[model samples]
Target: AIAGWTPVLDVCVITGEDGPHTALVISAGGVVSDAVAPPGTPHLRPETITLLSALLIGDWAVADASPDGARIEARGIVAAYAQFHLERSIRSLGHIDRTE
Candidate 1:
């Protein structure tokens, strides 16, 4: 079993040409999983599927060059995830120290 916090990130991208696309990313115990849907995927607007697709397919150039709202959202998600994990790890270490 994965013994760690798993945060789900919802990233949306909106551009002048394409509408909006959304991608759901989940990271658990160093394993990453994601899913991207095209336009008209229930409550999500079609935007960032292109960016997610690029990342999924290992198109670094496209993903890196993406200058859209998705990029900002992605960065924020990563920061939050890192902070959360760091805090959790620190707390876990403190508990271990107290017990020992």
Candidate 2:
């Protein structure tokens, strides 16, 4: 039984070209947590954080106005993360032998 196993959503935002990135994790219980970058990782500016937060909350207005590079990087990161998470979850459920 996969007890207490709830889906989690992780979002990462990159400030700009070669800029620092920050990640946020939201659990199925609606709990939000911040994921810090490892040591030596560049720190993001307060404005960058705010912009990313807006993007995270579905603020299309802000997203539409954001720099192209930043927006594109954010989208790519999100897509990659979603794919990896989905694959991991499917694998954890075990494999089924279709051949009888």
Candidate 3:
């Protein structure tokens, strides 16, 4: 029932006081790595930023972003965990009408 555009909601993970928002994604090496792209884009620039966001949490701080991928303090599922939460959130938003 959480409606309205919540900026904080959009913020799936806030590592530090002011850090670039990020979500988790599978890397080319098949690792559940931090997002290469910033949040909310399609392909990589998806408007729906849940896939990555669902795995993040509040305490994790943005460690770095390199050719490898985004880095954070959190580990394993706790870090990669945001995906499930995001999936649910995206589902809650419901379906879009493509019948135009």
Candidate 4:
């Protein structure tokens, strides 16, 4: 089975050197196995991804503390998407835990 402190697993879509690429992994803690992404997966910029990650863990204010209008829009989109998925995952896990 996969190991380590991965309470959350997220993907950052980036414009890599080799055209549009999806992040296989990022940040601290653990390895990724059997990583795969189909073609044309939607992706956000790295800055947006960072903001989204921070927001996911309830640090939205810190991310948005000082940013321009463009930055604000990007962060908002990424943050919204990230929060939805993360919360859904947490609820699913909680349900599984309770049922067990």
Candidate 5:
């Protein structure tokens, strides 16, 4: 995720019972090791990532602008919003050939 930030997803895992049981995974950790969403879950909304980036970085400008996760530099900010499905923005965080 972000250089020093992690992703956050409100997951509600439900199970069958007399009524119903649900487990919410609000925060896990870095995507490098944790999985927030399930394997069957899909990551299609970029807005979610944007809001997450804002919450994680406490920067509205950055978060509002990162709703797309386009540039490689923007992956961290995006992944910071996705806990289990952090792969979507991984490719964006590539090696930058800029030393200036």
Candidate 6:
């Protein structure tokens, strides 16, 4: 969680029937008092908390669109965060230079 941000965002990645699923635990009303999530949720802290919080606050529509639920669900929050917030559109990274 970033400084001055609440209600204590906790994220988790769990294997589901389809694949990995991201479970979010958000504190109620941005307050810590009612922050307890439902049972079986993992306690996770994002490495890039400020960036993630900014993304969540600004670009939720882009962030929610993922190929697979598992795609955005990872123990490494950076990948998930980047895929959702940083990625602009799908594009080929490179093309084969087949002149050999």
Q: Pairing residues by index, what is the TM-score of model 5? A: 0.26
The residue pairs in collision within model 4 are: none
TM-scores for every candidate against the unseen true structure = 0.34, 0.39, 0.19, 0.35, 0.26, 0.23
Model 6 per-residue lDDT tens digits across residues 1-100 = 2543332233321222231122343322221112343676443333233334445577665444433332233223433333344345323312523232
Write down the RMSD of candidate 5 (Cα, Å). 12.4
Candidate 2 has an lDDT of 0.41
1-100 per-residue lDDT for model 3 (tens digits): 1332122324233232232343433321112214444454322222223323433332223222211222222323222333444543344223644232
Cα deviation in Å at residue 99, candidate 6? 28
The residue-level lDDT of candidate 2 at 61 comes to: 80
Cα miss at 5, model 5 (Å)? 8.9
lDDT of each: 0.41, 0.41, 0.30, 0.40, 0.40, 0.35
- The TM-score leader among the candidates is 2
- TM-score of candidate 6 to 2 decimals: 0.23
Selected candidate, larger lDDT, 3 vs 5: 5
Candidate 1 has which clashing residue pairs, if any? Answer: 20-45, 20-46, 20-47, 21-46, 21-47, 21-48
Q: Considering TM-score, which of the candidate structures 1 and 6 is the better prediction for this target? A: 1
For model 6, which pairs clash?
none
TM-score of 1: 0.34
Residue-wise lDDT of candidate 2 within 2-100, one digit each (tens)? 343332222333222232334333222211223443344433333444455566566878766776556544444444345455554444223543232
lDDT of 1 at 81: 53
What's every prediction's RMSD, in angstroms? 12.4, 12.0, 13.9, 10.8, 12.4, 13.9
